[model samples]
Target chain A: MTDHIHDEHCDHEHEAGINWQLVQGWVQTGILIIMGLYFIDLALPGGQLGNYINVDNFGWLTWVGAAIFLSMGIINAADLLRTRPEEHHHDHSHEHDHEHASAGSLSSWIFLGIATIPLIFGLGVPSKPLSADAISGDLSTNVSTINFGTSQSSIDIPSEQRNILDWIKAFSQSSDLREFEGQAVDVIGFVYKDAQLRGTDDFMVVRFTMSCCVADARPFGLVVDFPTGQEFSQDTWIQVKGHIEIRSIDGIDTPVILADSVEVTSQPEQPYLYF
Target chain B: MEFDLTIFATRFLGIFIEATPFLLLGTLASGLIEAFVNKDDIARMVPHNPVLATIMGGMLGFMFPVCECGVVPVTRRLYKKGLPLSTGIAFLLAAPVMNPVVVASTYAAFGAGPVLYGRYIMTALVAIGVGLIFTVQNRPQRILRPQAIFVPITGGSEAVMPAESERMELLPGIKKALLLAHEEFFEMGRYLIFGSLLAAAMGTLALDKEIETLASNPVNSVFVMQASAFILSVCSTVDAFLALAFANTFTTGSILSFLVFGPMVDIKSTMMFLGVFKRRVVFYLIALPFLLTALLSIAINLNIRL
Candidate 1:
């Protein structure tokens, strides 16, 4: 009985031993909490907020997830302190080496360092929305591919609400875009240079679209024929007042908005279109 | 490769932030199973008939609803609890995309298009096919590493001390789950970071004018999207939205390939596979899905209405 009790006490001590695993665990917890707080702490939903998630409705889900990490960290920290260090659960082989996995081990440190990189950068770096440069980037090259109609959204309304996304959706569902030709649209997006619409003042007005998060965001838009397309700088937010017309771009009859009026505007609170 | 810092950081955090919740949910579920469910019960529950067990495993996500990032650890916990190799593998592959959340999301993104139905059918086929491949084997001992083997639980509830009685020790049992969850999260999260890094690198650098150029051809388009799917590592919960974005540019079949094959095999989950299976087995696991998804998707791409 005495031997068993002593063994239990030793086990408690071992668990409580301060080591690299416990430290890493606390750090992991901190990383999760900080990432969560970064989103929750925003005063106005900014580009960084959109960088991680798309819908505000499900924003609270992120907080719950971060709280799990925080609580788990506290639990590990509590365990480290409560048990007073006789021998760690994994450190039974030698007279030395105290750790949850292995204290001061090379792999342990490497994993810890790798785990900490994101936390370091995530906190230090300021978040920017995917810019016009995104088009040249790998993921955004196919800017016209994203389809954005929620079946619940009625595109057949008297005035089609073809924000860059709505245009893609209507363009995608129809074999011939004649139905949409001459339809007036009030579309807002950033000016992006398109290879196909090279000259003659044809630049795309695009809004990047996201489903679950921004990593998956893809630029979705239609070519806007502004007489001064060459003058407006790439990535300048602009509102195009126009009517949709089917124009042949690189073979296919694609929708292009003939802008009657163009006005410069600041980027909106929610820059990316969400589903 | 010179990574644009902003692009890389945005994508890295994006994948991590998006996947973290599902991963947490998976670990918590794993903890609950580890704490409450006995090893024998899992063994007993998994049907013995190879085909039935494979189908059952593939369909397990109807109840579990874990994301691809999170399902690995849950499957690992189940594997450690004596779940048949066939069932565990099928569940691991199928649950991420096959669950109702994936279904609703896929439907929402594709609007009942072939991509939606194709995503379901292809995921099931790949999952059940992989599961059945393991059925001929003698309990996969050679494939699994020593660390992954099922070990008898020695501690009481795995979270609390053995001296505590099982009936009255609910909090400690839960504490045990949290403790185990933290440990599991650390173990699995390391791989997740590596996967996300590779994915971010690929997302930032690899996609370019060549992909857009090749996307004009049906065959090349399918291959490009499949490769992109493997590289992107977007969570299954929202990949359909990503695929929907590709709908107009790529064939329905190619978009379907992206939707079906991505969650099944990707950089992030592929890295995690090394933690669970032997090096050679991981290669085979990857190649099988890659080949099958490619062949079936290409076939659909060729035959389906363009």
Candidate 2:
């Protein structure tokens, strides 16, 4: 009776013993679900996706991607659940080669660790928009040829309207802004002072223009002059209403806004201007 | 050197968020190609004439329109289905930047500039040139890994039963594709994560001091931008924007080289290549693109105004 009981015990172990393959599959699937949720969270209201991308345009793509991840996660989870421990031992590749490396090996665990760390940190951390350090961090503060809708392109708005992007684009393309030199201008951007440009009172009101994401964001701004007594903190978002005046700096004609009033407003609803 | 951990972390997350969705979509497309498409039918459609086959492969992006990350797995699948080595290589090199969406985006970014025409013409030249070189070898057995070997890597493996796969209903077939895609994503995503972190670290270290010096030398600038493209591993769909920042500082030749070469090879894509190709082949894949792009770019610098 003891010998028969031992055989039954062996049978039970074979059927129910932890299948490392299934475990690894579940781990991967679990991460996928986490990632899917992470993206959904980003795509949702008050999420960081808007900070990086134009939510109005690319939000649908994010949802579709999340669905794919979730579906894959579900399918993998189902497969792992249905897989018998014996079948894990009996898959053709394993049966054919006893040397077949199981997914539960030390290296597999290491791989899993590396793969999930980024997602964990990514979701865990607070989102911060790209700032002045990103721009000054580049090679010398030299003129970079402007390309519209690219990561490095300064945020430019080409329309006559008060939008910063179109205004910068128009300003960059035109050698002389004599036509709009005295035009009344209203714009909003963060404070970035280029040390090389004119005096202590001269600072730029800049915004970064992004194409796909923040990885491609480039700072574009127009030079502004505040009255001698007023100084704005670095990276402070402000609304400036002024009139354009032509100033020659570095042998190039630049548009300088003579500010009538500068308000230190809170951050805008949309942090980045998308192409 | 004090590492700006916040900048590193933010850049890391930025690149990760940008590229992951595309990678997932690529894997799903890869799974679809594997589960539903008949190998024999694919083999039949790809022409037997070596040169023509390669040109067709370069243009294959027009139909598939997958990005660099997606194309890696799809090309591996096609190679397994007995697609000619030349054609497969051609398709692999050309598919990322040559497609409609990418071209349209490039046009939108730069307007009607030389960058647009130059990118298309040069990508074709490089893809065709690379494909022709592979035609001489014509041996997937020597080049690709065993898993990548879809045919009898030697001759003993049983041929895939196309008829059985054809009979498989759409729902079951799609389910199979999903499973395959899941497996592939798990396999490939490991490499992508590592590459992304490396890029993030590179971005944070403030390495442009070195890149700035190289920007002036006609020949060295091309090499610098190529190295930057390889290191940054920014997706082709958006690399133009990154390259644009360098436009005034760096030569147009260098920017064009960056635009064309980045989609074909990068640190991240190099990692992905290991999943589908042999070490020797991956080595060649990297070295050949670098050499060809450098030579072509240098020539453009010397002859063309850019």
Candidate 3:
């Protein structure tokens, strides 16, 4: 008799607790939003985010964005389509809350749109490269020929001599560092020695660190055959005293640094190189 | 028309593949917790002390370690079981930011130094702070509704018939977990792709140069980076790369803000929050983290010499 009573009570509770409509509504709405965003992107031609959309550098990302935008829009639209608006039998207590929500949606949309404007504009522009002089630090005066620090170059060099030395030669012509010959300037960086080129005392390399992204990181190695070539290792951070000079390596005139002294200091707490 | 047709078909296929894994993992963790942990468990754990509850909620990220996508469904289940709104909210916030996987990835990206340690400490503090703030102001009962649970059983016509009690056993529970994980992965993955695409497009179109100009003003720069982090949609794993790319472009404060804030809140994460919490609750969760992140970023940048 007790078991029967418990079973009957549980059934009543279960029946009263089910809110199928809300769950179904969520599923429907989610589908609608996802679909809508994608369809709109397709129909609108280039997504019309002029000054808002970019795809030039990282083309792999375009497919990813299209997926997310379309999915959310479709889901929202689906929810609206399936659920017939049910008239709420407003309990006197909840009526105030409903009225507030009705008033708030408009403001919410406006806020969302306004917030997205700068975001759109930021995405639509091309990136500006940090100029060569900025990283090498005003080599226009006091340095004979500035070394190409950790920055990347697009110049074409000979196939046989296709390394940093070759890169420096090609980069030098464009930046016109040859004109700055006979001037002295202070250069800061860590020391590395390339084994391939350095015969007992041949080359010393310097690396620059970029805090977040490495693509823009420039490596400016100063080729100094100073007597103390054996002192530095692969990543030993150091500041060397050197002046830029033109030297012949592999039949090409390359800008090399002749070191006056090499000082090994404690790795500065922040090792990143910045302009 | 030819271009559109090819692009549409390619995009559809890409979305399906990307969303599957995350969804699977999210569902697996969410389902198991749902099946075993109940309201009494939460009520007993909390209510005794808010401090203890906050610690417990924050630490739960280690045990379950659900991604942002799976967090909501698991969180929704907890709400149904009567966990406090603040505790559930805290769990949602902490799980994604400081989970084992995310932590490991962060350590790998920044190295296990102040960047890693600071991120862990700050993320926990921020999550707990937000949770407590909400708890003091609002009642969990008012905002959370009971979540619906769907269970399917086989019958005589169904090729696989099962006893009623056996149907509710742990295997079905595992199946539910897997399913939820897959769905959540797909959802979050889709958003992540969208963000990266938008970021890349902006990179190519013209905004890349504009971002550099904005970096001139220290304060406005922070705001721009935080906003870009959300719009870019890069995953936490690779976001460090994107942040590094802009090293020359933005101020240190802005770069820090972009790295810290992007993982915590984004458009997809916001939508996921809406799916779980009430609109009001979602509003606070979405708005508060972004504001807090922006403020914290500026403070860190201003004070620290580095």
Candidate 4:
């Protein structure tokens, strides 16, 4: 594959025609630059990056990636300008006996196309956070057993200030579910109804807890027992003003929110809770 | 379930963005090794005995901290630098999980517990065991692809260039390194992209429900977690936290298997492995680690409790 590096005929003049190898190299360089810029855009605050990943964990790494891409693109651009003929000559090995080099270049072009897949998806598709549709049966309603690092008890935080994750963490840390009973709760999360809660007046108010990105996202939420819970469709973001109540779920006594009001709300700017 | 383009795109890009940096890092490391590190240095560093060398290879990740995404290109580069096949294979398998970054991450997720210790130990055993298999049945021509098989400069092959004659000064070497990095980024990045796409497409499927159903069965859970690890292809650095989500549900042994086997061979790493090793070797690479991890984990599941 690297036989062209030792080619003695590297200084030969090129014919007056379209240089497909040069074009492919230029396109690869352009894609690299675009990818660099795309990563930079993802790193920027208030960008769509949070929709795809928990930027809090990987935000700085994204910047480092941008720098690497930009440097690689620059090096590629430099290689194009200085050694254009020498690099391009190997692609036309049909005239010579460098069949291996020609095959290598052909495979390189295929690889170049493969490298462009991310660019097409990143730019062409509109970014959106993973919703209830992204959740399979891996959803976690029993958060008591999950060890999300050191849990900061949300029990101390003023009732309305705690989010779904904080409440879940607090529950995980506490032994008694009854302690959370009657705690005023105002949390916003997307609706998710399990098959078991299909006909019941209860549905999970869930937020995906992501330590890395959406690929590692696992839904965690508290069950909201509301008379009109059936009205809220799955993946619809909603704010439920309610009070906590310990209820028998399956065979375990779990903390279930008894909602006084459920109002539809827009998805949060950062939809996922960072673990 | 109906396919959602937006969700698919989001998941695809998510894996892409998360994995690409490590791929870039791998290429950069590969370039640096190609430019600066010589064949003699690699030969001198590796022990002469195959067993010790394989064990040393497993421990080499401490010196080089890289995830599975970064390990492939570096391993290929080392092979090019005339690193022994057994050592290279061991490094390739163990480095992803044995590194300090992964150790810290696993510790953060599970603490100084059996999962943390079991993960590293199982990875070492499996990696060394596989490396030993290569040691017994060593054949570079058959195991590695034509390009990946190392040809010594002393072989006097006409197509090969002498190392001392064409070796560049420091500045030119740095420039050459950057150029090689640029070339390698595209070469390895293609596999990373392809694997990420496959993983993302699979992510949109309801495979989780099927897998979760078998979580309670000690025997099946090990296979299920390993299968999940292969399909998900989550980076080893943060995969501990991902495994944590299943800590309460999956058996301890199965979680350890996921931690050990996932980093050694996944969809993306398997694609990268295909780039370096021949098709048959790639199958052995996947199957060896898969079976080794599964057996060890199941033994723990059935016999001992974590």
Candidate 5:
């Protein structure tokens, strides 16, 4: 009895001194609070608040995780199998190295907060993509609302020269696109192969490449009615020039620049079209 | 209060769904790795050749893929199981970038390109570089000890002690598997909840319009945006589209920086790093990626003809 009591005391003294109950309680409470917040987000509508049901992509991963964890738990059980119950159970002194996984230094958080400041203030709060009816959730919604229906012309270019909408938007807004629209504005972008648009010797969908952050990207391309042209593979970036013509593609009003001609630009010094 | 609360709730939930695919994949991959991979076997494979070891460490991730979000917990496990710190660090950095899932997602998002190849190559090199640094400078004893498992009881519900009699009984593999699954689900699930929420808040409340405007500048914009990317706590899979949206506003350098930095360091992942590794280690690890990205972005910009 004395040995048992001493062993218990020694086990207590060795380490992991904090009661598991207390730690578990803290973790559980924190999780519960967070889960509640997620639930609240789910109940609300619109992105202005938050969306909670993001588990779709992650659902499979979670199940896979459960399987993996089960495997580990079993392995651990196997490791513990050989030890005597008394030695394993009652009281075993624990040793703690006393090193902590750093929570991050004060300077780090300050730097982090400083870094995050721009993202907070830089972009307008983004709403979901514009609907067909058009909801001006923000002031920008008003921009699209104006005169979008004014011009609809089909400026056919060879399929080799269509541009991504992201680039087109940028070009439309840029000095290059606005001033040089008719002056043979040459831009480099990638071809997006559309099966439906294939075999038409005019207008290949092109996309400007951005390494990251897709918000400000525009996709505008050359509308080439190539009398005799070769089929350019999809995702190929080519420098092509044509006069700008605003028209409708597949019911949506889009810009169709008539490519006077197309040139296969070698992978330029800059490989991608930055918005 | 009611109006603000309603808007906040709705927005928060929207971001949560956006991040779901990433969060679930990261956690599941992490959980799977922790269960099956034997640490001792991995550690023994590290060779005297630094280059080989690094590549081996990075590539090994395909087989024993893990998540950066759960890096600390898993790293701690590796330490306990006797993995070399250098290899472990390499795996920590490389696994997030080079793993099968992240690679597949990147291919899907960006399409196969020099960019896709660049991400893979660059991450591998960077991870190796950091691992090499650790190898030369620090010893294992200084950083971590063996992994420790704990049990506790409350209100006299049960005695808080290691299982004794049942320790050696090799239960049917199925029985043992079920118990582990239960523990891991609860342990890791809780953290996933916290991490996803934090990521959602960053995406929603913080990344606003004004920030986008600042990112439009060609000169100071890339650094600022890249820095923001590091802190945003977003997953790599979805961030590509978000980065594309910013492409028009910011310089190429900033965009590259954003993509490169975000995958390596973020709010929750940083916390996860700290939770599992020494603070000094996490700090250094985080710093290396940002530094390399800045340089790489500059190079890409200077050489970019378009």
Candidate 6:
């Protein structure tokens, strides 16, 4: 497919003096190199890669992509240096189909522009993880349906050490909410309040768990009951020191955290929890 | 809600980072096929009978193992190397969902139950059904773009041979493959990026919130899921987990439609398809699978339980 371009360029070699084909090749080569460096930067520690994706699942794949891009760029650089314009003319002499050559150059430039859209967004826009505003439909409070490991083993973990996901898993496996009564709870998550919890002294302390990226992000939370729960606005990251109590939420028996304290905290470096 | 640029950028980069490796692998394979594989070999391996050939095409994913993002370039390259028309079409549609990686992921998400089996069975039926439709107008000139067709429509035994000077030894072939891979990468990479941009924009705008309203209606839910699948353009290997998020709220058929149809045709894969097939053929590629999967899923919704 590429041979046609070189063959076409031979026709305009003398008239143009500049090999537009070579310039196009170098542009692509530069784009590949920059793209390679971008992926490598994301894979590094403290990089913003996790803000977008679950790095645990795709961290190594990012490195593989970097290698592929860098290697392809280097190979193209080598090819452009080794092969003279005259050699390309001779190598693809018979493959010239001139009708599409003019159209091909125009379309190739358009494609090159299209290929840079990600780079424009990746560099130009500041990275931010999805927050409560990203919640599209109803918040997932039902713990029974999710397959977040139903071994009844997470309950054994000390209350202070367990995160939102661990608590949800424990809730999923236990037959009764009373089993978690008075369990000391210390977890950090963002506050999410919907219409139902707006008037009451309750709101959801939620964290999104993703098996892949944010496209599949599913929110899981336990209802928090505080006298001033409404004061902690939506999507405010907070550390809740509390104890679990069985309460009837919308007439369904569920575990609700009764908070001793709620302190505002900064978002974690890795915002989304991975299963 | 107003468009959030930050969220759009995050989602765009995430989708691109997750998908690009597969696209690179695809172009690399395309390059290798261009360098090493002979057209005669592809012609020889495919079954002569059209029906068997189409079925074999749907099954080819076990060997190639490309998702929707990677399948287009590989399918185009295979076409260039003299793969039959129906078989190539079938592979293009089925390989994304039929591969082992997707199977394992779907099984992990849904278990060995109706959703898992329904996905594979539905994909095979739709893909092969579309492939068979191509057999009616089996001429390459009718279906493929001019640049995609390499071998003449003559019988396989009379395949055209490359010039002796064009053939290469192992080391040179490897170099040639890399060079071709570089070119193919740029050719196909643009489509992936463009599709990601559209998917990201739609995601940031929260268009899915509008679709969620239609989920309660059984028939509307199937089309709604299909629209979500097309817009989201998530990778097939991990999309099962995404579908799991909707397992409770969505009907069985709609969820199955998302699993089966998402892999075959999405914004990204459709853009890539435009690179290989004629403009009209791309329409059929999208429509054929969409209609077939919808009809079958609705049938399952109305009749079957699981």
Best by DockQ: 4
**Chain B global fold similarity (TM-score) for predicted model 6 against the true chain B:** 0.92
> Best to worst by TM-score, what's the order?
4, 6, 2, 1, 5, 3
Error of 3 at B305 (Å): 11
lDDT of 6 by residue, A1-275 (tens): 13332344355542345566667778889999999999999889988888877898888888988998998898888887887754553222222242234322676578778778888888888877888877665553556655542124587899878999899888776788788899999999999886556568898888877777766666778788888887888899999999999877577777888999999999998899887
User: Which one wins by DockQ: 4 or 6?
Assistant: 4
The digit string of per-residue lDDT tens for model 5 on B1-306 reads 113333333233333333333333444444444445444455566675765676676666676555555454555555544556677777777776667767776666556775577677667767777777777754564554323222222334135532322322334433433333333334334344455445534433134456656765654575786677765555665565555555555666677677667777776577556445556766787888777777666666666553
Worst 10 residues of 3 chain B by lDDT: B1-10
Per-residue C-alpha lDDT of model 4 across residues B1-306, encoded as one tens digit per residue? 579998899899988898888888888898788778887788789999999999998888998888899999899888878888999999999999888889888988888989888998999999999998999867798888765667665543243333632445787676667667776777678778888888988883244556767887889999989998999888898989888777877899999999999999999899888778889999999999999999999999998655
Worst 10 residues of 1 chain B by lDDT: B159-168
lDDT of 3 by residue, B1-306 (tens): 112322222222222223323433454456556555644556676766776676667767777676655566677666655666677777878777667777765655556665566566666777787877876755554465323212233343222323323324575554434333333433344443443344333321123445557875778888988887765444454455456445555676676677667766765566556555567876777678778777776777677554
Location of the lowest summed lDDT over 10 successive residues in candidate 2 chain A: A1-10
DockQ of each candidate, alpha-carbon based = 0.41, 0.34, 0.03, 0.47, 0.07, 0.44
User: What root-mean-square deviation over C-alphas does model 6 reach?
Assistant: 4.2
- After superposition, which runs of candidate 2 have C-alpha atoms over 4 Å from their true positions? A1-16, A54-57, A88-101, A137-160, A195-199, A228-231, B111-113, B153-167, B204-217, B241-250, B304-306
lDDT of each: 0.71, 0.73, 0.48, 0.81, 0.47, 0.80
Error of 4 at A229 (Å): 4.0
Superposing all C-alpha atoms, what RMSD in Å does each candidate have to the true structure? 5.2, 4.9, 16.5, 4.1, 14.7, 4.2
Q: In what order do the candidates fall by DockQ, top score first?
A: 4, 6, 1, 2, 5, 3
Worst 10 residues of 5 chain A by lDDT: A130-139
Candidate 5 residue spans exceeding 4 A from truth = A1-50, A54-275, B1-40, B144-219, B304-306
Q: By TM-score, is 2 or 4 better? A: 4
TM-score, per-candidate, Cα-based: 0.84, 0.86, 0.49, 0.90, 0.54, 0.89
Residue-level lDDT of model 4, residues A1-275, one tens digit each, is 22233234432332334444566678878988999999998888777888877787788888889998898888778877888354444221222233123322566567677878888988898888988888777454466876665334566888789998888878887888788889999999999987667678889899987878777877778888998788888889999999998887687878888999999998898899988
Task: Report the number of clashing residue pairs per model.
Answer: 11, 8, 74, 0, 92, 0
Q: What's the TM-score of candidate 5 when only chain A is evaluated?
A: 0.33
- Please give the interface root mean square deviation for model 3, in Å: 13.8
Candidate 5 lDDT score relative to the true structure: 0.47
